[model samples]
Target: MKLKTALLASVLTSAAFAAQAQEVNVMSWGGSYAKSQVEAYHKPFTAEFGIKVNSIDADNPATPIKAQVEAGNVSVDVADVEFSDAVRLCDEGLLEPIDQSMLPAAPDGTPAADDFIEGALQDCAVANIVWSTVVSYNSKNVSGTPTTIADFFDTAKFPGKRGLRKSAKATLEMALMGDGVPAGEVYDMLDTDEGVDRAFAVLDRIKGDIVWWEAGAQPPQLLADGEVVMSTAYNGRIFNAAVAENQPLVVMWDGQILDFDLFVIPKGAPNLENAKKFIAFSTGTKPLADQASWISYGPARKSSGALVGLYSDGKTQMAPHMPTAAANLENALVNNFEFWVDKDAELNERFNAWLAN
Candidate 1:
């Protein structure tokens, strides 16, 4: 009887530890982007820490984090989100404040805060990559090559349905850029109601032929299906479709809107310690560099830039494909997270009304 009781107790203790060793759930935008994280972060993390990572997808990771936190049913340990959304959520007390001191410094001994690009670090989030939303078109579908942001709206020159994200953030910036608003002045113009009207006026020119897309994957699929001759897409998606899948898609860097994607721990994550460990490891110089080989997005850390090289295909260089590449930066506009954080509700309301009309 004593032996049997001891055996049962041991069995129960082992089972509890096994259950506690299960995977940490991470939520992110799906498609090739998620695959990049899986290869660069998840697999290595599991091997190193013995804790598995279960990646989940959403249309926008930020949206679900908010819902889960407010309902007090938080499940996601970490999320990859845009700069503006990260800022907005952190402000609303939905995110766990990250301690920058815990971040690993650069190889050269520069602190993480200084090694990261300006605006890459936030109070509650740490940026991982600097990506862009740029104009892309199927070369096979277009009559002539379109070279500029203005060409995206010039239906008379490159006529076909346009694919645009169903959001005000990138879409409004692109609309204003198409209307000949210089990159430097985009935010200033957007600050005024009349400027917002001007942006809508630009969209009105192409609204009749617009096919709205809500997912990052949809833009590439839309172009592939001959539904849209030209679309605005995250640079990494177009790079994957063009390089990996052999699609005849061309990306126009002109008027690209550059922004950061950050890692944030939701306020009440079940595995808070492991989540922080994952963020630190994933955003470190080596892993960030490894991710660049899988996708075209530039790493947020200055130290990681030197380590980036050819794509996973082993032929194409990743630098020129990056949003921060000198050629790509000519007319690029860095997304103003502060502006978005302040005006998101107001602008989105107007945008929805405009879409309804």
Candidate 2:
């Protein structure tokens, strides 16, 4: 279940070097998941296209991506952009707008431009997978279990220390839900200033009991090590961590925040064509399912959805973030990245200021 970067690099070098090293640089959020995608899918792709891919880690960083693009030092030919960042990149003229004819098209003749799942399309990028920041509790520590964000925040209802992510985008949406907003209304609420403040107010109630985690990796690790009894976590990270020990953790789809990872080309990318090819190839169902098997991502490919139907033991074979698994949740969140992208600047500032307080 643990992703080994060294081993993956060795395998990829052998496989890809034997094929293509014409070399295109990709700035993705490098880590186990990104590595696996490279070693598994990208390596084979290079073999076919004779194009080498250099993956650089451009994880959710402190500085804005627009700054990097503006500086003309755009190091990434292909980037694994967050939808929110992609929007900002597009607005700033820091993204290479994709041409549908140049990319893969769906069976119905719609180009890859429209192949993305509903609520996932944007002006600058394509969502590659879906995930959630949801209630994950160590079964070993708690009496029963928390079923939703409300339960996680309900200290009197379920007494224990809880974990919340440090980001404002998803956190604010979760807060809005806790404040009694319906899952579907989250984006609509964020469209108004009053709703944003109202969501923050909801967070203030449980702020004392909540410990903050900054990345997808932290919350699951904390859960596995018994650091926090219960907290919110990326569905895949927690599920992947559980592969070894079968940790007593669960993701309640109820009011769960829908999140995703996207792929984009930075402004002034040299290998724009190659980047498009890589994206189209990687986004196909089988490669996506390859990620789903070990990585626990909710595949964005329509074919990945069809492919999952072939697996019988959905619980045993799929992680909670999988479309099959998430289908069972009572409540689910739909993240409107377009909204976050537009508001990330102001929202992130206020979020940081609030966290500091």
Best by TM-score: 1
Q: Mark the 10 consecutive residues where model 2 has the least summed lDDT.
A: 306-315
Q: What residue runs in model 1 are displaced by over 4 Å at the alpha carbon?
A: 2-7, 10-18
Stretch of 10 with least lDDT, candidate 1: 16-25
Residue-level lDDT tens digits of model 1 in 1-357: 999999999999999977785668899999999999999999999999898899999999999999999999999999999999999999999999999988999999999999999988899999999999999999999999899999999999998999999999989999999989999999999999899999999999999999999999999999999999999999999999999999999999999999999999999998898899999989899999999999999999999999999999999999999999998899999999999999999999999999999
How many pairs collide in each candidate, listed in order?
A: 0, 4
Model 2 clash pairs?
139-248, 253-331, 254-331, 255-331
Score each candidate by Cα lDDT: 0.95, 0.71
Instruction: Tell me the lDDT of candidate 2.
Output: 0.71
Cα TM-score of candidate 2: 0.83
